[model samples]
Target: MKAAIVPALNSPWEIREVPTPEPSANQVLIKIGASGLCYTDVHITKGAIPTQFPRTLGHEPVGEIVEVGVGVTSRKVGDRVGVPWVQSGCRRCEWCLRGKKMFCQQQIGTGVQTQGSHAEYMLAYADSTMLLPDSISYEQAAPVFCAGYTVWSGLRFADPKPHEKVAILGIGGLGHLAVQYSKAAGFETIAITHSKNKEKLVRDLGADEVVADAEALQKMGGADVILVTGNSYKSASAALKGLRSDGRMVLMGISEEPLEVTGDIITNRSRIIGSMQNGDEYLYEALDYVAKGKVKVISETYSLNDISRVYDRVANGEVRFRAVITDM
Candidate 1:
């Protein structure tokens, strides 16, 4: 089996032939069809996300189940599924017992702490695997595992009202999908970005309006729910200025610096919240939306052998939205 391995911290992806892994009693073995490369992959290579050496670094993987372990009944051979983040939590914990597994401190994170999907074959915990819809291809469904799932979960965290407006900050990978989901839900969607070139693309994705920044969002009568998808905490901090009274700002982006909160962001108990992949219900609905064609993943594809080149492109910030590693 050919797999891309990160030999050490700050190292490039080395394509090597390794023995295929056998699934454990509670797991299933999959023949990976596609994997999405995220900016977090670059951070992993640079040791920004602390990870063990000689690791596989992709969390967004969709493929076919070629084999299943003895104890697995929920999934079987020939099943099409995706191995996503939030694999499992310590089932005994309070959060897990209460059904809020995403809050479990002993949660298992794909790629960051386990063998990821940057390989031809990998073992997945049967319980955490999601059954893929027949209408969505592996390449298109790959990003939904992380980018799509996170933004949608953030929007849910915002809990917008029927007449409230939804605004998306940053028009990159996650933001692009956020705009579509916001519009598809029948809200007046707004996209906030400095890139003049993305106005048409954003509009084409069903953005009802486009704004340059926080100030521009304010002029349009503030948004009831703001989903922040850029890694810049300053941008996220500034975006709070555009949140209407009692509105919620859901931060989906990960940043190194502290997110500053000011008096302007505190009107009528408005909330500043951080969110990631939420409950299973959110992921199920997120996948359904994309499967039904309400959301689209703008992506570029590469062969598994060219995984290193994917890194270079990601480092140069050249990916249109997301990069998928396929047989192409």
Candidate 2:
């Protein structure tokens, strides 16, 4: 199998032939159809986040199952599935028992902790693989494993109601999807971006308003819920100031720097907040939304051989939205 292998940090990936993995107990071997390139991959490549070297760096994967191991009964060999970042969890943990598998202490991420879906064949725990609807294409289904689902889960944290103002910070990968999910969920969606270039693009993706300037934040009377999707602590702190009293703010972007928030911002307003990834329940809801044509993934498709260049594009914020690496 040919794969783009990252042999070292901050180095270009090399396309090499590697042995295809076989399914282990309770796991399945998938012939990857498509894999989503996320900012996390860039972070891992740059050593901003630590991971094993010689890693195949793709987690948002859509693939066809070729074989299943012992004890796997939910899916069959021919099933088309989406593999999320969370590969598996210790089901005995309290968090996992409560269905908050993403919070499980022993959770293993597909790319970070194990062999990921960057090659022709990949292995995944059968329990964590999601069966995609026949209607969803592999390219479309790829980003849903991470970007789409992250926004969906973040919205759950915000708990927006109809007519409520929800602001999505940074109209890029996660923020673009956040805007769409906010609209589909019946909220008044606003997209905040520093780039004037994204104004029209953000509005086209269902944002009721696209704010290009920081002054626009004050005119909105503050948002009922703010989803921080930018990878900047300063931007996130500014967003906290733009939240409505008693409103919630969910952080979806992982930053290397510590997030700085003024104590007064939270203490005076009684704001509730947190970060989240898709868990078992949220995963099902996210897929259901996609299957029903509610949440849509705005993505650009690239060939698997172009994985290294795609990472550079994502790191430089050159991608229109999400980038999916298709196996061609």
Candidate 3:
């Protein structure tokens, strides 16, 4: 099997032939169709996130099951599926027992703890694989496993009711999908971005309003829920000020800097706040939305051999929204 292997931190991925992974007793082997390239992959390559060398870096994946393990009852050969970030969790943990597997003490990410779907073939635990609807193409469903699920989980945390104004901060990968989900879920959606060029794109994604300046945000009179999806603490902090009384802000993007929220604003408004990723339940729900065409993934496709180039694009914010690596 050919794979683009990450040999070392800050080094280019080498296209080489690697052994095809075989399914274990409770796992299934998949012939990867597509894999989404995220900032997480770039972070892993640059050592911003800890990961082992020679690892395949991809979590948002779509593939066809080519081989099923002996005890894999839920899936079989020829089944099309999607794999998400939460690869496995300790089932005995309290968090897992309560259906919050993303918070389990022993959580394993697909690209980090195990080899991922950046290759022609990869392995996944039967329980972790999602059945993809035949209607969704593999290329289109790739980003839904990560960026789509992340935004969906973030919105779920916000718990917006019908007609509530929800603000999406940053119109990048996660934020783009956040706009769509907010619209489909019956919220009055707004997209906030400093880039004037993205205003049309955001509005096209079903955002009721698009704000390119601070004054525009002021005109909207603040939002009931604000979802911050960038790596800037400043942006997150600014969005906090743009929330209505008793409004909440969910931080979804990982930032290297410590976030500073004004104590006065938080206390005075009595805002409920936190960040969340998709648990097993959320993943299933997100996939359903994709199947129903309520949510769509906007991505640029690249070959797996173009890993370094894609990483540079993601680091420099060159990609339109998200980039996916096709294993062709």
Q: What is the C-alpha RMSD of each candidate to the true structure, in Å?
A: 1.3, 1.9, 1.7
lDDT of each: 0.89, 0.82, 0.83
Give the local distance difference test score of model 3: 0.83
| Model 3 CA lDDT for position 292 | 87
Which residue pairs in candidate 2 have backbone atoms (N, alpha carbon, C) closer than 3 angstroms, thus clashing? none
In angstroms, give how far residue 89 of model 1 lies from its true place.
1.5
Over the stretch 201-316, how does candidate 2's per-residue lDDT look in tens digits? Answer: 88887888887543576576878888888787678777777777777778888776677767867575746466667566777777777777876788888887787788788989
Q: Is candidate 1 or candidate 2 better by TM-score?
A: 1
Candidate 2 colliding pairs, count: 0
Candidate 1 lDDT tens digits, 151-209 = 99999877888999999999998999999999988899999999999999999999999
Query: What is candidate 1's local distance difference test score?
Result: 0.89
Tens digit per residue, CA lDDT, model 3, 1-328: 9877889878887778988877889999989999888888888888987888888888888999999988989998999998888877899989888877779868888988888778888889998888997888888888988888888988997788776799988888899888998898888998998888887888888998888643577577978888888878777776666777778788888787777667857565746466666565676777777778888888899987787788789879899788988855
What lDDT is reached at residue 240 by model 1?
A: 86
For lDDT, the strongest prediction is 1
- Itemize residue pairs with steric clashes in candidate 3: none
